[model samples]
Target: MRCEICGKKLVEEPLKIKVDGSIMFTCKECSKFGKIQREAPKPQRPGVSRSSRVTKRIQRPREPTEEVIENYRDIVRQAREKKEWSREELAEKIYEKASVIGRIESGKMVPDLKLAKKIEKLLNVVLIEKTDNDIRDEMGQSKLKGSTIGDIARIKRN
Candidate 1:
């Protein structure tokens, strides 16, 4: 280990010191500038290796996410019309402004999951769908690996 303050190589055990509210591993000579602190021993889990923990995380499956449907505008508009509710009435029911409802109906805005859920419960319509996390290429092949920084750099160069 090296000294934090003096930047000199430490032959002996480094001292833990608290300087200006920050703890640092410093050499014995520079330790006089700060209050000496006892080093706390790290707790180890029984029979749990770091490699095993990493492998377990890598083997875990990705969870599906909720996404708004493509024709949400038409579905919401039709549901509202069937209930004989105006844009202002629907907006008031959802605690949102009439402009928000108008924008959603006109395809100028897409409702988030929270808003979609509220509208679905109030209008009794499906506006959100669960989608898998798998990404596909143009040829419909699953892309398990993500693009690295080197790949992005090559693309930019091209």
Candidate 2:
């Protein structure tokens, strides 16, 4: 080990000292600049093993997540038409560009949660739905193969 302040190699045992309210391992010469501190033993649970802790974490329930509906583009378009609002008008109400509205309506782009919520409120349409985490877990368990990186990336992008 090396001294924190001087960066000198420590041939002997390093001292634990408190300098400016921070604990540091310092050489004997540098330790004189700070108050010596007593090293405390780390506390560990008596019966817990690393594998048991991992399994406990894995068994924890996942929270339900929200996702956009498959027919969101059609729903948004029909709702906006029913309200007799132009694309530009709807975009202005949602603080988005007309091009973005056009792309979403044309099914070229998928709106994120925040944008979908804004459009849903303005047009009074249901575009997002909550998916049960337990259902997803069951599906995942039934699949024989693991998800590839591309599949994971696609999930993340959405």
Candidate 3:
């Protein structure tokens, strides 16, 4: 038998797994990538085809919620420093990669809702918030003249 993913010849029975909901016979190495999905009994009708019996799946659109607060990097960096925590320490405490913490602190990456929440709790700071305009924008009903989120942010010259 051959592996479905790597196409390697196998001496043992092919591993059965469900990759993105499709059950496939895979090799030992390839099988680690997906969940185990039991094979459904095929219908024995003479004129029925398996492809025709399958239904198309439609997924509902998701709404965008919890945008990063203005000046998130500065806030996070300040909070982390106030507690005398290094970047590695914060990453270790949060169970995330040090690169992720570095990116967030340098404003190179925005923290997702879950990561933001973790950061908020750890640093005692607010990293994300939901606004009426955010909801309206997600629903395709935004009426703001500004094209970007930073349009409303105030810039001060020292």
Candidate 4:
């Protein structure tokens, strides 16, 4: 290729172009003279990237426990602080009374299963069911004869 303008070697730029609705290759200098429009590279279809094949590990659900409860409270408190929410505002999100949330945080009550689950969901943390007793006696149906109703009632009432 030679430069049409200066007769210099028009290094092999091999410009594919369109001229008068036709396509061909020419030197850059000639391209400028002809006002030839260069063909734009075809847009490539995006491939399935290797990253797409990489699978993320599924996180196992954590067992709920006392530690989970404390951690959950801490997390909720932190989020509430970051969001600039009063305890009342946070309570609104969970449809709970702020005082109840306060009681939970202060460890004044062990949340029952349902309340614990609700708290866990609202706080985005696990806060219950970590320890499980498997022994049959734990179910309170032991073969051994248990104490009398009055004794049991007295014990329970206390």
Q: What is the TM-score of each candidate against the true structure?
A: 0.46, 0.47, 0.44, 0.34
lDDT of 4 by residue, 1-158 (tens): 65444556756775655667555566775665455643443324344333222321112223322333434455445545656778888778778899977876666755666777675566544454333223335445233113323322432343
What's the lDDT for residue 108 in model 3? 96
Clashes of 3: 0
Candidate 4, which segments miss by more than 4 Å at Cα?
1-72, 133-158
Prediction-by-prediction clash tally: 0, 0, 0, 1
- Residues 1-158, candidate 2: write the lDDT tens digits: 99998999999999999999787999999999999976642325545465556665565546556778787787778778878889999999999999999999999999999999898778766666655436444665324123323333333353
Residue-wise C-alpha lDDT for candidate 3, range 1-158, written one tens digit per residue: 79999999999988899888677889889988998644664445544455324421112224544588777898778878878999999999999998999999899999998998898889766667554343464443453323223322421110
Q: Candidate 2: which stretches are off by over 4 Å?
A: 1-61, 133-158
- Clash pairs of candidate 2? none
Per-candidate local distance difference test: 0.75, 0.75, 0.72, 0.52
Write the number of the candidate with greater lDDT, choosing between 2 and 4: 2
lDDT of each residue in 1-158, candidate 1, tens digit only: 99999999999999999899787888999999899976542324544465556665555536546788777887788878878999999999999999999999999999999999999889866676656534334243233113222322333353
| lDDT ranking, best first | 1, 2, 3, 4
How big is the positional error of residue 153 in model 3, measured in Å on the Cα after superposition?
15
Candidate order by decreasing TM-score: 2, 1, 3, 4
* Better candidate number, 1 or 3, judged by lDDT: 1
